[model samples]
Target: MTTTTEPTARPRTHKRVPAAPNRARKNPTRKRGPGSYAVIAAVTVFVLAFLSPFAIILVNSFKTGADYRANGSLSLPEQWNWSVIGDVWERVEFTQKLINSIQISLGVVLIAVVLALFNAYAIGIGRVRWRTAFLVFFLGVNVLPQEGLVYPIYYLFKEMGLYDGKLGYTILVGITYSAFGTYLLSSVFSSFPKELIEAASLDGAGRWTILWRIVLPMSWPTLSVMCVFFFVWSWNEFLYPLVLLISNDNQTVPLGLSVLQGQYSSDPTSMSAAALLGVIPMIVFFLIFQRSLTRGLTAGAVK
Candidate 1:
C-alpha cells in the first residue's frame, strides 16, 4: 500500500531541550566602577570638612595656656590639660547656667508647640472666617527682623515690669517668638487630610480629642522639628537675654558663656574649656533629633 505510508512518519521523532539556568544564579555580585570610587571620595571629603572645626575645638580644649597661646588654632595640644575643665566648671558655674538654659528652652518649646498646634488646627482644619487674615498677620511677624524688633521689645518689657525676673521675662520672649512657630506649624496642619477630622467627628470624637489623638500623632515629625528649632534658638539667644534680663544670677547659658569669656580672658585654656562645655549640650541635642529635623523640614514641602 504505497510503501507502508512512508515508514509511518518515522515514529514522530522529538528532540529533548535542556532547561535554562536562572539568571539570578550567575554573578549575583554587582560590579564597582569609577563612580563608586568617586562617591567614596566625595563622602570622605565632606566628612573631613564637617569634622575639621570640631577637631580644632577638641584639641584646643585639651591644651595648656601656653600651648594654646603659642600654637595656632589648628595645632594639637602638646600636653592634656585635664584640669582646665574643672577650672572652668567652678569659675563659670557651668552647671547652674546649664540648668537655667535647659528650663527656659524646655518651657519655650512646650509653649511654642502647644500654641502653634492649636493655631494651626484652627487655621488649617477649622472653618473660621478669619483664617486667612490670621495667617497673614502671623506671617508678617516672621518677615520682621528680630534685630529690628529688639529695641522695641526691650523697651516694652522695661515698661511692663517684665524685664528682670527669670520666669516672666523668658516666658514673654517665648510668647513673642511663638507667632513664627505658629505660622510654621499652621502650614503643616493645612496639609493634613480633612477626611481625618471629619472621620473623627463622625465617630463621636470632640474637636479636642481629634486634635490630641489624631492630629498630634500625625504631626509628630513637625512637632519634633519645631521643638529642636525653638530649643536651639532660645538656648543660643544672647542679645535678647543680655539686653532684657539684667540679672547675671539668672543669666541663660549664652549670656553666662559670654560672661565666662570676660572673666577668663587671660586664661585661654579655661576659655576653650568653657566654650567646649557650653557647646556639649547643644551638640547632644542636635545629635538626638537631627534625623527628625531633616524629615520634618522636607516632609510636607512637596504639597
Candidate 2:
C-alpha cells in the first residue's frame, strides 16, 4: 500500500500543447509582381483611351472656330471663348429641346414603370395562366428590331392622327420600353418571397393593396434603376424622334444637336460646344441616380 502511494506521487508530467499559428506572420501581405503592375497599367491605359474623346470635346468647346482650325482639337485654346456655348444654345433653341427631352423621359419612366409593375404582378405574383407564354411574348418583343417596327409604328400613328406629336411619341416609346421593363421585373418578382404575400393575404390585404404596400416598397430599388434606364434610353433615342418629331418646336436634344451638322461644311468649335452641352444633362442625370443604380445592382447580392 505504501509503495503504491509512493509510486503514484513519484512523477506527474504534463504533456505540452502546441501554440496557435500567428496568422498575420504566416500569411504575409502579397507583394505585387510584374503581372500585377502590368494589369494595373493596362487598366489605366484603357481608362485614359475611353476618356480622351470627352477631354478633346471639352478642350475644343472653349476655342473659337479659327483657333480650333489653326491648332486642331488636341491643342489647348489660346483664350477660352465661353460665348460659344451660349451661341450654340441660342442657335439650337436648346431650352425647348431640353424641356422636350425631360418631358419625354419622365413620361416614359412613369408609363413604363406603371405598366411593367401591373404586367409583372399579373405574371409573377398572380401566377396567371400561360405565364410562360406571356414571358416568351415579352422576350420576343424585346428582341424585335426597332427598325422593322418603325414603318408599322409610323403608319399606325398616322392613322390615329397622333403622328409627329410629342404625346404620341411618348406613348409609343413608353409602351415599347414597357416590354423590357416587364420582362426584367417579372423575373425579379417571380423570385420574391411568397411568405410575405401569403401573410398579407391572411390579414385581408387585397391584391392591389399587397402590390402597393408590400411589392412596390420592396421593389423600389429595382424600379429606380428602371426609371433611370428608361430616362437615359428615351433621352438618347434618335431614329424615332427624327422620323416622328418633324416640328422644330417638338424636337428633342438629339434632334437639336443634329441640326448643327451641315452636309457640306460645319463649324467644328460649334459642334464641339453642342456636343458638350448635349452630354451635360445626361451626365447630371447619371450623377443624381448613381446611388440608386448602385443600390439596385447590389440588392440581389444581399438578403
Candidate 3:
C-alpha cells in the first residue's frame, strides 16, 4: 500500500494564451435619430422662406395688378388672367429668346465641358511641364471682375470676327465658363485612381479610348453638374450677351426680362408673368439634374 501511494501521479499543467481582440461591427444603414428629422424640418423651412418671393411672383403673375396691390403678394388670385402669359410671350419674343438661350446655353455647356475635360486631363492625368503654373494662370484670369474683361474681350472678339450671333456668344461664354470648369474638372481628374489609368494603359487602351470609355463614364456625374453650372451661368449672363449681341434676335432671357421691366414697368402683373415664364425653363432644367448636381458637388467629400 505504501509503495502504491508513493507512485501517485504528478499534477498536470496547462498553458494559457491571450484571446483574440474584439472586432467592431460596422453599420451601413444606421437609423437616423430625432435630431436628423429636426434638421430636415429646419432646412425645409429655410428653403421655403427663401423661395417665398418666387412663389409670390408666380401667384401674382396670374392675378390682376389690383389684386396684388390690394391683397398683397401672398394672397391668392381673385381673378385669373392667363392671357397675360400670352401677352408677355409676344412682347418678350419668347420663342426667339428661348431658342437663343437654349442654343447658347447648350452650346456653351457642350464646348466648355469638352474643353474642360481635355484641359483637365492634360493637367491632371498627363505628365505636363509647369502644369501647376498653367492652372494658377487660368484661375487668376477669373479673379478680376468679369466686367473688367468686357472691353478687352469685346475688342478681341470684334477683331477676330466673333461677335453678335449665337455662335460667337456661345464661344465667348464657353471659353469664359471653361476657366472655372477647367479648375473643377482638373481636380476631379487628379482625384481619380492612378492605378486604373495605369491598368488601362497596360491593357492596350489608347488615350482617346480611355477618355471616352473610362474617364467619361466614370466622371459623368461631375460632368453633368458642370453642364448645369455652365447652362445656368450662360442663361443668366447679361453683360457679355449685352455687349456682344446688338440685336433683339440674339438676346437671351435675362435681357428679355430687362425689356419686360422697361415696357411693363408700370404694370407689375405683366412683369411678373413675363419673369415667371422666363424662368420656367431654368427651373425645369435644374430639377431634372438636381440629383447629379448634388452627387457631383459632394464627390470630393465621399471618396
| Candidate 2, 60-107: lDDT as tens digits | 999998898788889999999999999999999999999999999999
- Candidate 1 vs candidate 3, TM-score winner: 1
User: What RMSD does each model have against the real structure?
Assistant: 6.0, 6.0, 8.2
Question: How do all the candidates rank in terms of TM-score, highest first?
Answer: 2, 1, 3
Model 2: per-residue Cα lDDT at residue 124: 86
lDDT tens digits by residue: candidate 1, 163-204: 877777668667766788778877777778887778889999
Q: Rank the models by lDDT, top first.
A: 2, 3, 1
Q: Which ten residues in a row have the lowest lDDT in candidate 2?
A: 1-10
Best by TM-score: 2
Runs of candidate 3 with Cα error greater than 4 angstroms are 1-44, 263-265, 298-303
Give the alpha carbon lDDT tens digit for every residue of 1-303 in model 3. Answer: 354446769788766777888888876897899999999999999999999989988888898777778988778998887888888899888899899999988999998889888999889888589988989977996686878989998898879888786787798779878888888878878788888889999999999988998888888888888888888988889888889898898888888877756543567888789789878998899889899899887776313
Give Cα distance to truth, residue 224, candidate 1, Å: 1.4
Q: What is candidate 3's local distance difference test score?
A: 0.85
What's each prediction's TM-score? 0.83, 0.90, 0.81
